[model samples]
Target: MPVELKTPPSDDWVPSMDDLPFHRLGGEEEVKALANAFYDAMDADEPALARLHELDAQGRVNAGTRERFGLFLIGWLGGPQHYMERHGHPRLRMRHGHLPVDTGMRDAWLRCMRKALDARGISGGLRRFLDERFANVADFLRNTEG
Candidate 1:
């Protein structure tokens, strides 16, 4: 679900997944762990999805891919803007446009993410919120019909 702002402006308004999650989700380190876990799970369990990414000599997603994603997640969770500073806007769909994302790929990606979140012990409302957000983005990135 894209962020919704119901606003004339609440006294303490913040973007969804903004500042609150950054702090509540244990800041930079935990977020980076989540990114790492995501790629690791993809590497282990989703060969088709993993092959779509740049791989290393060991056949895992390359370090650069991991680093960039870590940076992206940091900013996405509102910890820092390093990803934006280094890469400009996320432009997620545009960046992913070259990939032939379809239902299968999208589902594979979500499974990896779910594994990552579960491994991290992410639960409760936070887990639900993240699940919805991830699902929305994954679906949005789909470029072809099944």
Candidate 2:
């Protein structure tokens, strides 16, 4: 697709995610817990997927890496730009370029996030929105054949 500019709608029109208030509803603390639970789910339920991560001596995702991603999620969900302030642009696909993100990896990653979302009681409209967004990112990350 090509870039196209158009007149903006009236001020009464609300931006999509802005209207959802996902981060506000989850809060920073809640998002952190969700991030940790996501990694925990990767550890417990998707060992093969977990192999793509850097684990700590305790056999869990590296603490700093986990924290960095948590920071990324916070900003990603319309919160403060902590991750960008400290680490610069996410460049998600570029960052994952070295990983052969095949269909299985993409699905596994989404599965972990979905489980994490479920664990946190994210449902209804918010859940649907988040799931679709996450799935899009996951699919976009794919770099290899099945």
Candidate 3:
């Protein structure tokens, strides 16, 4: 089962478009576009993303996976917190522990993230911030020495 991120129960909690920096900067469509770009990078790049493709081939990441990923990103980018609302703390390392992620994997993830950010046409500041955040999470997701 996929891990879920949890959030405090608050009936007053209503996600607004302005809640997410990405949305405030771009929009909902832009966010989706960014996600699509990221997925495209993961799909197109072989040398750095072969593992991801293999995972997809193994049925580990399907359409649902993409949707979850996009939802996670939406929340992660300070948006609606939909992921946490529906799912729970994103224990990313623990969840990805089963994957054979290493330095190579981390780099590949970063590369795809960079490509995605570029595709969004976001500001340099946001891109840098995202790069740092992605690096930290990707590093934590690494479960191997190779």
Which candidate number would show the highest TM-score if scored against the true structure? 1
Residues 1-146 of candidate 3: C-alpha lDDT, one tens digit per residue: 99998974343433355444555446555676677677777877744454444345553335565666777877777777777877786788777777788897788888887887777665445555566778998887878998
Candidate 3: residue 53 lDDT (0-100)? 45
After best superposition, candidate 1 residue 122: deviation in angstroms? Answer: 0.5
Better of 1 and 3 by lDDT: 1
Q: What would the per-residue lDDT of candidate 2 be over residues 88-136, giving only the tens digit for each residue?
A: 9999999999999999899999999999999988776667767888999
Question: Which order, best to worst by lDDT?
Answer: 1, 2, 3
How close is every model to the real structure, measured as TM-score?
0.86, 0.85, 0.71
Alpha-carbon lDDT, every model: 0.87, 0.83, 0.68
By TM-score, is 1 or 2 better? 1
Query: Considering every candidate listed, which one attains the maximal lDDT?
Result: 1
If both were scored by lDDT, which would come out higher, candidate 1 or candidate 2?
1
